[model samples]
Each structure stands twice: as structure tokens, then as C-alpha cells.
Target: MARTTTPLTNTQVKQSKPTDKRQKLSDGGGLQLWISPNGSKSWMLDYIHPITKKRLSMSFGIYPAVSLADARKKRAEAKELIANGIDPKEHREDQSRLQELTNSHTLQTVASDWFEIKKSKVAETTSKSLWRNFDKHLFPKLGHRPIDKFNPKRSSALKLSFDIGI
Candidate 1:
């Protein structure tokens, strides 16, 4: 028969003392609070990776900051993802990748890409003039803004001079 473990309480967690070695206090369902020898506490969830079938552990957050209730909620979400045939770690990685891509695809970045393609095809003088125009007119307002939020009509230089070649 499998042994059953008792869940932890707020008082127990609060009163937990640091020992010479690191200790893990189980809150059940693969959720546990890890106490380091230095008394630093953090939350962790242990689960079998859906694809690899290997035991994996994910850190929820530092204790007190994460709180017991919040850790349980995160555990439930990870469990749900596992049940849905999704790997929680992979899902998190995918979301981070999307966020990074969104952050990188700014107006300045798009403009730089256009400059690169045009650079090889145009004369050096024209290239420098084109970049100078972008720096003088459009970049000041829209350089840092993401492409999705950029409005062409807001900049007369972009709409008339660049778009229509005026």
C-alpha cells in the first residue's frame, strides 16, 4: 500500500526551522516547501513530464511571496495542463518565446530589416540618406513602439514621404 502524507498548515510552514541540511515539507499532491540550510524557503511542484515520463520538479516561487494558497492554485494549473496532454514547462517556454518575439519585433527592428535588404541593393549615399531620414523623422516617435501598435497616419513623413515616395 502507498503511504499517505499529511498536508502542511500555515502555522507549520511559518514555524519550520532551518536544520544543518535542506529539508522538504510536503503539502501533498506533489507540492512541497523546500527549506534550505540557510532558512530560505521556496515552493516546488513535482510531476511526471507528460512526454518524457520522467519525474520533473518546477519551482513555483519563493515562500511568503508565493503563499500557500497561491502555490496550490499554480499546482492545480500545472496538473490541468498535464491532464490535457501538455507539458507545463514546454507551455511556459512557448509563452516566453512569444513574448520575446513580440518585444523584438518593434518598429525600429522592422525598419532596420528593411534597411538591410535595401542596403545591398542601393548605393551607399542613398542608404545613408534613407537612414538619416528615418532617424530625423519617424524613429523619434515610433522607434521603440511595437509594429502592431504603430499608426502610419500619425506620422506625416511616414504616410506621405515614405509611403507615396513624395
Candidate 2:
């Protein structure tokens, strides 16, 4: 028979004190609060990786900052991802990288990089004129937008220019 664990309460969590050895307080469902000998407390979840069939531990965050309720919520979400055969850690990392890329690759930033290469291959005066045209006409309208958000069909300036053969 499998042993059952009693769910932890907020009062019990708050009353827990650090000991000479590291202590883990279980809240059931693999959610635990670890109290280090140094008196730092943090939330952790132990789960078996769906693919590797190996046990893995994932940290949620520190105590007080991450309340008992919040830690439980994150545990539920992590379990849900595992049920879908996705590694929560990898998903989190991919999300962070995507956000960084999205923030860095705005339309003006990409255009500036393209212009730098164009400058090396074209005449200085030709490059200057072309850049000036874009700086004045395009940058003001859509330069702040991310590259992924740009739509040629939605841009009136691009549509008008294209329609008139510019």
C-alpha cells in the first residue's frame, strides 16, 4: 500500500524553524519547503521527468517572497506540463530566450544593421541618401515596432508607396 502524506498548512510552514541539518517539510504532491542550516528557506518540487524516467528537483523560489499558496500553484502548473510530456525548465528557458530576441529585434534595429552592410558595398553618398530617406519616412511610422509585429498589408505608407511604384 502507498503511504499518504498530510497536506501542510500556512501556520505550520510559518512556524518551521531552521535546524543544524537541512530540513524538508512536505506539503504533499511532491511540494516541499526546504530550510537550510543557514536559515534560508526555499520551495522545491520533486518530480520524475516524463521522458528520462529520472527524478528531478525544481526550485520555485524563496519563502515569504513565494508564499505557501503560490508554491502550491506553481507545483500544480509544473505537474500539468509534465503530464503533457514537456520539461518545465526547458520551457521556461525557451520563453526567456524568445522574449530577449523579441525585445532586441525591432524594425529600426534590424534596418540599422542592414544599412551598415549596405554602406560597405555602396557609394558613401548613395548610402547616406538611402538611409536619410528611410530615417525620415519609415522610422517615424513603424521603427519602434518589433520585426514580428510588422505587416506590409497593414502599413499605409508601404501600401501607398508600393501602389505608386516608389
Candidate 3:
């Protein structure tokens, strides 16, 4: 197979040293390793926004942590997204937001966190009553649900429970 000129070799990447000014080493297909003045290196892709037709960059990860091969793979994936008319930067942001949403504390998680905090500040009897109230009233209906989805105005269950004094 004929050797490509653009993709950088491991030796070339390993030999790269940072200078006073930052340097960018192209590994072909828009994958590049940016060497900072402090010798820290990170992988990024330089691409054009699919919709806006503007130049943009997105970081993959740090060098060593994100090797040249890994960077190339990331670049290929970005290229695929671009070909599909999706900007990689925006796609990345959307993925990040989705991850954040999924990982955010649910009602149960927030209640537990609040309980821990309050336990440290309040009397033991008050803490026990709070826990009893949560276990009886909140956890059965809303604990598993994310806090964002809980609308007080729309919850008939809450109104019923309040009327019954449970």
C-alpha cells in the first residue's frame, strides 16, 4: 500500500515538543494535536460547520489520553457527522447536555442529598419526622421521577394527599 503523507507517525508525534508559542501538528483529515507552551497536547478537529459554512474546531481529548489513532477515529466520526449535515460542535454540545440531563439528580436523589444536609443541621427528632414524611408521602409517587418533571400545579395526587392529610 502506498504511504499517506498527511497522517503523522507515532515517532513524529512523540518527538513533538512545545515551544514558547503553541503549535498545531496536523494528522490529516482535520485531526490535529495542539502543543501548548507548557508542553500539554490535546486533540482537536478543524472542520467547517455544515449549515453555516463557517470554520469551527472541537476538542476530542488530551494527547496520550487520546492517542493519534484515537484522534483519527474521532476525526472520522466528525467527518461522518458533517457529511450528514450535522455540525460536530453542536452535536457534541447536544450530547453533553443529554448526558447532563440523564446524570442529574432525581427527586429521590435530591431528597436524599437534602436529608443528609439537614441531618447535619437539625435535631434528631425533626430529622426522623422529615424522613418519615418523605418515605410516606413523596418517595412512593415521585421519588424515581426527575425533579424537572414534577409540576406541583398539575399533580392531582399531591392535592389528594394534602386533603387526606397523609
Best by TM-score: 1
**Lowest summed lDDT window (length 10), candidate 2:** 157-166
* Candidate 1 local lDDT, 9-62, one digit each (tens): 999999999999999999989999999999899999999999889999999999
How does each model score on TM-score? 0.76, 0.71, 0.64
Clashes of each: 0, 0, 0
Pairs in steric clash, model 1: none
Selected candidate, larger TM-score, 1 vs 2: 1
Off by over 4 Å in 2: 117-146, 149-166
RMSD of model 2, in Å?
A: 3.9
Query: Candidate 2 or 3, higher lDDT?
Result: 2
**Local accuracy by lDDT, each model:** 0.88, 0.88, 0.84
**Taking the tens digit of each residue's C-alpha lDDT, what string does model 3 give over 1-166?**
7345577898988899999999998877778889999999999888899999998889999989988888888889999999999988888899989878865767788778867987988789978987898899888988788777767678875566557643
